[model samples]
Target: MQLINYQMQRFWQYGGFNPDLYLFIPLSQTRYVTRGYNQVSQTWSPVLKKHSNVSEALFRVRATKAQSTLSRAQRKRNLKDAFSLSHCIQGKNIAIIDDVITTGSTMDAAAQTCLDAGAAKVWAFATSLTPLLGK
Candidate 1:
């Protein structure tokens, strides 16, 4: 928690805070049930509670296999049309938060879903970035 707080503070210092909304990547019902919580949400909840702009505005409408085993192209295909917006984010700037980013296909799908729901712009933040093989 201390590390997350430090990172959040650094993000604020760098002017990466203050998005209109903070949207955590939604886990599928199956995954959520299996895991009992979304780790990203769990980690960000305290800071987000202070800001009061945290929202579960997006949800997964379909399930996909664990991304760790997938190739980049397969990851993109797996996430296609997997998310749905629960409310209008019209003209709002959104920041999608996640624990880690690998190929970024998941974030791309989430951003596209937000755009489809009328978000003005979307930015993504992750605690870690996993380098792709041979990169």
Candidate 2:
């Protein structure tokens, strides 16, 4: 959590701003049931201020194969139509938080969902990034 806070501070300093809303990447119902809580929200909730509410506007409509087990192309294909927005996000600048970024397909798909729902802009943040070795 501290590391996320420090990184957020640095990002804000460099970008000269913070997001209007924070959105945690939603896990599928099956995954959520098994995990009990969203790791992204659980990790960053402590550092987020009251003004920046964690929005549950987005949700996974269907389950897909885990990104870790797929190639980049498969990852992108697997997330197709996987997410849906619960409400209008018109003019909101959103930051989608995830615990780790593998191929980034998951976050990309989430951001697209927000944009489709009328968000002004969307940004993706992860605690760590895993490099795609050869592709």
Candidate 3:
């Protein structure tokens, strides 16, 4: 968590990614029930709360196959309309945080959802990025 916090701080300080609100990618109900907590939210909430508002801006509409287990096409298909906005974000700049990014389908879907809901701009941040492998 310390390393992630450092990187996130650098992203804001050096990368100049200031946002009106911070949003963490929500876990599906099924996954949340099994895991007991959304690690991404748990880890970053306190850190972000001090500087910016942290919001659960979206919810998973349905569960899909794990991204790591899917091909690129399948990854895109799995998240289609999978998230629903939970609150108003009109004209707000948002930062969406996720634990890991692979093909970026998840972030794209979330950002698109926010955009469709009238958010001014959306930026994505992740603790790690997975190298793409043969689908």
Candidate 4:
């Protein structure tokens, strides 16, 4: 997430300044609400405060499986309405963050949710994209 947050800051600085920027995160497998060492969040807290334009990085939804073993069609089917956004992202440019991106179906579903919630543009930034199984 550090990489994504840094990229977002650079985009905001060098790229056209969009009025609103939101980070969308898919919730964990379970809702235990435990706070572990979130490196990305720790790095982003100060940066977000520095720029008030970052409205939120809220986890308004959850995803089912980890998307490692599901077939292509099953992955798509597994994510149908499996996620929902609680916040209004309409007309905003959102950046969805995940550790990796293989087929992009998971990210696609998540981004679709954001768009359906009114997001104008959804850009994905990830640390890596491995085509191997269990990615």
Candidate 5:
């Protein structure tokens, strides 16, 4: 928790991004039920609570196979049409947060959904990135 808060502070200080809205990738209902919590929200949201723009508007529409168990191509397919926006954000700049980025398919899908909903721009921030799976 300390590490995530520190990283978020650094980004706010130096990342030069001031988004109109900040959205975190959400876990599906099934996963949240099994885990009893959404780790990403728990880790990232507290640091962002002072910012009024942080929102829970983006949501997973259905459960999919875990990305850790999939190949890059499969990862992309797994997240297709998996996300939706709950509000209209036309001409707004959005920032998406996640715990870790692996294949980037999850972020891509979420960003695409935001764009399709009329967000003028979208940025992705992750605490960590694993090497490309097939690299």
Candidate 6:
């Protein structure tokens, strides 16, 4: 997770990274220690350059059951309004990059936040998206 965050922070060096993209990082509601991950401290040059475009959101309005533990409907309700946009994302193609995507409710909530914030469109990219395999 730490590595992922670092890479995300460094993405600014790549031409693909831009200010119009709002990078919202979901906060861990529980205090449980991650197996091996750390929040980035020093802002890399790329991160600094991307600062104008990137931002963080600490939504999670209320702590409910984790995605794995909740039913799809429950997950949707739990994550509803769980995030807030930090900047005006209107008329922008906001790409939400998360380490994983499960039921997609969380992503929906994130996208909803951007939409509510006036974003014209929302694109999501995840390191791993869990599909309902072998159904």
lDDT of 5 by residue, 46-125 (tens): 78889998898999999999998888999999999999988899999999999899989999999999999999999998
- Cα displacement (Å) at residue 95, model 6: 0.8
The Cα error of candidate 3 at residue 92, in Å, is 0.5
Runs in model 1 deviating more than 4 A are: 13-16
What is the model-wide C-alpha lDDT for candidate 4? 0.65
lDDT of each: 0.89, 0.85, 0.88, 0.65, 0.90, 0.61
lDDT, candidate 4, residue 58?
46
The true-versus-predicted C-alpha distance at residue 88 of model 5, in Å, is 0.5
Model 6, 1-135: lDDT tens digits are 465456666765564655466464465556224533313212222334535655554245555566776677788888766677655666877767565687788888888888778777777656667864332
lDDT of 6: 0.61
**Model 6 stretches astray by more than 4 angstroms:** 1-19, 29-52, 132-135
TM-scores, each model vs. reference: 0.90, 0.90, 0.90, 0.69, 0.90, 0.63
Model 2 misplacement above 4 A: 133-135
Which 10 consecutive positions of candidate 5 have the poorest summed lDDT?
126-135
RMSD of each: 1.9, 1.8, 1.6, 3.6, 1.8, 5.3
Please give the distance, in angstroms, between residue 10's alpha carbon in candidate 5 and its true position after superposition: 4.4
Rank the models by lDDT, top first. Answer: 5, 1, 3, 2, 4, 6
- What lDDT score is found at residue 59 in candidate 1? 89
For model 3, residues 54-107, the per-residue Cα lDDT tens digits are: 878788999978888988889899999999888899999999999899999999
Clashing pairs in 3: none
Distance from true location, Cα of 72 in model 4, Å: 2.5
Model 1: per-residue lDDT, tens digit, 1-135?
Answer: 778788788877897556888999989999999999999998889866778888898889999888888889999999999999888899999999998899999999999999989899898988789877852
Worst 10 residues of 1 by lDDT: 10-19
* Clash list (residue pairs), candidate 1: none
TM-score of candidate 2 against the unseen true structure = 0.90
